[model samples]
Target: MTHADTPAVQGGPELAQERRLVTEIPGPRSRELAARKDAAVTRAVGTMLPVYTVAAGGGVVVDVDGNSLIDLGSGIAVTTVGNANPCVSAAVAEQAAAFTHTCFMITPYDGYVRVAEELARLTPGQHEKRSALFNSGAEAVENAVKIARAHTKRQAVVAFDHAYHGRTNLTMALTAKNMPYKHGFGPFAAEVYRAPMSYPFRDAGVDGPAAARRAIDVIEKQVGATNLAAVVIEPIQGEGGFVEPAPGFLPALLDWCRANDVVFIADEVQTGFARTGDMFACDHEGVVPDLIVTAKGIAGGLPLAAVTGRAEIMDAPHVGGLGGTYGGNPIACAAALAVIETIETDGLVDRARAIGKTMLDRLTALQADDPRVGDVRGRGAMVAVELVQAGTTEPDAALTARIAAAAHAQGLVVLTCGTWGNVLRFLPPLTIPDHLLAEAFDLLAQIIKES
Candidate 1:
């Protein structure tokens, strides 16, 4: 059986797994939808690509205009198991048929307990762990911070530069980007601090350990260890250009957290669940955090998130301290369980590593041949290339946008991210066929050349 026929991509509306352009990128049908959306939806909601999706499975998203575009964005790294994964869909259907919700917080069910059990079993380290489920990454992250403060009896929380935590008030403070996420919103949650992150491409001379010291020094001078409750970071920065910290950076930071009794929180919302070649990005460096915030790829294309951590730290909160009305809904829990089973059974961690190799190999080659390709970095299916002026490190965001637009027009769905808006990121679903990835890169290379 082909890879696409497996649980990863099965149980979806099937279409030809090839890029086809029957209409312009945003055809008449999509334009009609866009008009309606503009009228009904808030202007604050923005879209990178305006094509309206009808069905998506196995490497392609079919548009309402009959355009089958190669999907390299994976809905911003949320569909790692592929859209409408059979395992997840089947679980959801069964659970929905049985009962949708009784509100997990009010009347707990076995599915919720089972999902927590799976998280305890799968997350790093064998230490006794506990999990609290939520409906979004923002909720999980906010809860982690609350747990940390409750355990450590501190008010200050430090997050790294170039971080993208979420959109809630507290998470907005945790996030670093200002213009889009924090522009008009002000007076964010108090006592949230920002620390410098290790960007290998930008900070050339600094190594991992030194970068850690630099950040720790800032933390000491600004938010003293006594007042700091947690230090939150992404093992691989997601919207901040898929920036992977230099070797030893995470371990050094983790060591400092341990020494200072700070709860280390890994916001693996974008890099978890085999998207980064390993089950979790922290696993690559062997730096197990005290608490890990997970979402995005947690429940295949479902709105679910989890904060899994050491039992002691997680249990510090009062029984009624952590919960939402819809937290750990039975349907979502069932989907999460199925997602875990599929990840284990399909050996998707290895598959992610293989996908990373393919992407990195192709991207680095483009970098070598073209001066516009400033840097290429990432792991597993999450890869990116920063665009720059031909000879300097100056960000060329215009060139990046042009290239991405070109790719979109030519039947490929790509995404651009980074603080400077100069990084092109690729997050193809693992269920995508090898040939589609190859074709996407080839088209990207051509677009870059033409641009």
Candidate 2:
């Protein structure tokens, strides 16, 4: 469906899009909900900020007790267009009123096809492409691997250190971290190999080409290119902290993949949409992946994921081989369609770049003052500051936690990531007001200084 034919977007709840704390961060009502959650919710299902949210829009999340916290996390980069986005909510409501789900596999729908078309058009490529929708980023990554293996008739997959694909058995194998995501989740899927990552902050004096060579060497020696089905990577590592690969790293890697007949997969789950200024993080370097897995921000805040790629590769699987019971649900498809329209009509890509400049400028200044902030990195709205010991690169995870807790207490929502858990990542919605962004950063700066 064309943008011109799209219907009007609905408005969100009547909450002032500014941060306000009438009480403590969680307040009374939220604590009550938390108590109830403890009684009912499983301990394995963890929460970052445990405040029970009543409403959220623009740049703030309002808890049940009426505290408006500045939302820098954006629900872990899922709400790039903002929480309860008008366009997406309206589409979802309309789709619900019409029909919730027909199960795209059993009965196809226009919304699903439209979403696939949009993914093909928007993802980084001019080549003929196709897409298959799923329920989560993990599902997309898994499906992408299936397609790759089927297309190449190869068994091996190459992932990188400091990479986070997902939580499924196969994805857990792809993921590098061990403590929470992989620990105790033993007997993971095999044929997945981990290579060195281009962490510029940690690997000083290592240029992009050198980093690429190091990873290529491992891939060639350990997992022969002929045996590898695909080389999957997050252009900017997400849960492992927003580690942007060096300048020439991605191009060199893509070139090697091309020459080696290995399908190159770019997992843009956290960096897709306008989160990285460009539609896809790979676009920054004009590197096109054979398959691009996207989720997170695809459907505003709905559960939707997709694998868009070269038509021939995607078509490798026979008919009825690539679908799920709830994959490409009509409501999710509607929301995704609306999200694509919102990003284009609202100029969110440019907005993300502006937000990045604002954040980088402020955080760079903060790093100048604080020796504990070892590195400030990331692109567009997906930014982070890695904390370390003064004058050294040793990660200070305790200090990072303290600063995050302090920010939460003061009604600011922040998230910590990185392999060592010392990176404070900020991912504000593209619709966030500049003033709120500035205020939240100021609050963070004050809290860091106090710590």
Candidate 3:
């Protein structure tokens, strides 16, 4: 399907209906819906903000209550091309109309192969590569580890502290946080180790190279490079305060992995698909990871994930060892193809860089004005502001909560994450209108100033 054929972007009248709101946030209608959800859905199912969105397009979410909230968090970085992106919608619809599911494992489809080819083309590195699709980020991560183990004949997987991988047993073991994600879900998969991440804001005196050395020292001493199959990292820590490693940190780590024969896995689930300005955050540092795990924005809101890596390593897994029933569903594959095409043709990668520049400038100004703002960090559009107390670096979770609540009350949707739960992350669609982004930032500034 071509963009010219999509109603949402073809200058059709329906474009106007895409973002219209008819009620207050979680309005009476949404409340009624939420009540039904509570009765039918599992209690464990969670929500960050209370507003119930009935429709989303471009950079705004229209709630059931008729509130048009500016979406700063792209469904936690899932809707990079924008919610209900026309290109992606058309592809999905067309594929669904043709064939919803054939269980790729049973009978292959062109969409799956096309998506794999696109992943190889778009992911960083110029080496021969291969890709396998999966149903979710966690599944992708798990399979990456499996491939790493099969290739290296190693047992252990090393991950950084304060990382958020996934919810499955293996991924939960790989994840760093305890509460909410792993509080009661104990007895996780073993042979997984954690090392300190380079958090520049708190590690004041430590420079980037020094931070890398410190982390490397721990990994070498505790886990020993030989037993490790892979060292997985979020190029920019996503749920961990959007932390970007020091300048030489990633390169140094990659070099170490190369030397020690450990597969360097870049978990680009949140930072890929031009969300981080670059097509992938590793591109910023010129670091070519051995295996790259991607999801989130890849399918423009569908459940799709992929592990793209060196052909040799990816092919190490025996046939039938790395597929899921719904891995790369045709509908999702079509959407992913459209997403990749849209990012490139629409110049969203450069747009993400421009968006990041604007966000960083505004956020830095906010930091200067507010002593409570401890740090403004990230690359491209994957930006974050860490909140601290008045005169110290003490995390102010309460203030963060207050600011987020205040912003939401005023019609801007923001997300907060971090080990201390004191960081505010901005994940607006790269395609968000300039005026909406500026207004959202201005509202955030106002809330910070008032607080």
Candidate 4:
């Protein structure tokens, strides 16, 4: 039978379930490969799974050992459209066969313009918009800060605590974590400030509006609104613990930014591209950011990033200041166009919302059974469950690690994040079959219960 005609063993979407495993977790070959990887790779480049994949498509990662493990992390929310999605693969292959690079600033190309047009149309806000392409999320964020500073003619850039923008010098200054990401890498860029974020799970007494006011007050008192170029935030804090802001917090902050002449930026690198229910998390609050920084899933696994914002604000930077040598590589641009098309044609946005509902339903039930699960929160397929010590609100990092190890031992991959490192995040592909999703949750629940 043709691949399409073959019934999926997992049984949900025929195409998705067609992928399957043929060996035990990490099997024999993957163990050998892991040993080789240990020898060649630097210790700094940390890996969560022991298995190395030989192929990936749809919702499964086929390891070199012949095991098809269900993908739930989506490469830290980078492969939302799916691994080796047909449309993205075709576009990249076609572009590779043709001219690969001319550097948009050096020669220019239609693919770059097409990708920019798509960003302008998709990003939040009804105002006239423009876009600048980059190679990574850190680059987009760094440039956004540059644009905001130029437009407002201000020096200080404000970011939220627990934010994970990027790892570049400026972005490292912007990021909040101190462990692996920011360990000894200091001497970051200057004129960067941090404000408290609305973390409801931890700050129980402070409501959404109150949290926004407190954060704004700090900005006004320390940096002063007039001296601030931009106030950047991730709507639902990723890496920091899938923390969704309390209702009205974002809108309140947006209003404050508008009144103070501070450019508001939404760092949608993790939450954008339908990873959240909406196209952008800003849509949930009807908040229009002056700039939106995006990457991760923008090119369906290829490296491409962008900054979409109000036309005037985006145009404030000098012409020569915006681009880079390989910002919009032809292959990445082609893949991005196809990624957006697939997101639209395959209805992945709606699928993201549906996936969130299923995950919430299952996780909520699991939460009811396990006291270790302190909270369940997130939008669309970007869901998380924060673990706590039984009968207390204290973070249970040890238990969280055990639960993740247990799941991985069962051939299911998972991820952990949070300032306290007690959050278990689920970033399953939107195209994952319902059966596989159910199986993943079942495995997770079993592990959590046993742990």
lDDT of 1 by residue, 128-232 (tens): 999999999999999999999999999999999999999899999999988688989988999999999999999999999999999999999999999999999
- Candidate 2's clash total is 0
Better of 1 and 4 by TM-score: 1
By lDDT, the best candidate is 2
Taken over the whole model, the C-alpha lDDT of each candidate is 0.91, 0.92, 0.87, 0.88
Worst 10 residues of 2 by lDDT: 1-10
Candidate 4 lDDT by residue in tens digits, 213-233: 999889988899889999999
Q: What's the lDDT for residue 156 in model 1?
A: 99
Q: Give one clash count per candidate, in the order shown.
A: 0, 0, 4, 0
The runs of at least 3 residues in candidate 3 whose Cα sits more than 4 Å from the true structure, single-residue gaps closed, are: 1-24
Candidate 2 lDDT (Cα, whole model)? 0.92
Off by over 4 Å in 1: 1-13
**Could you tell me which residue pairs clash in candidate 2?**
none
What does each candidate score in C-alpha RMSD? 4.2, 5.1, 4.2, 4.0
Tell me the RMSD of model 4 versus the true structure. 4.0
lDDT of 1: 0.91
Mark the 10 consecutive residues where model 3 has the least summed lDDT.
Answer: 5-14
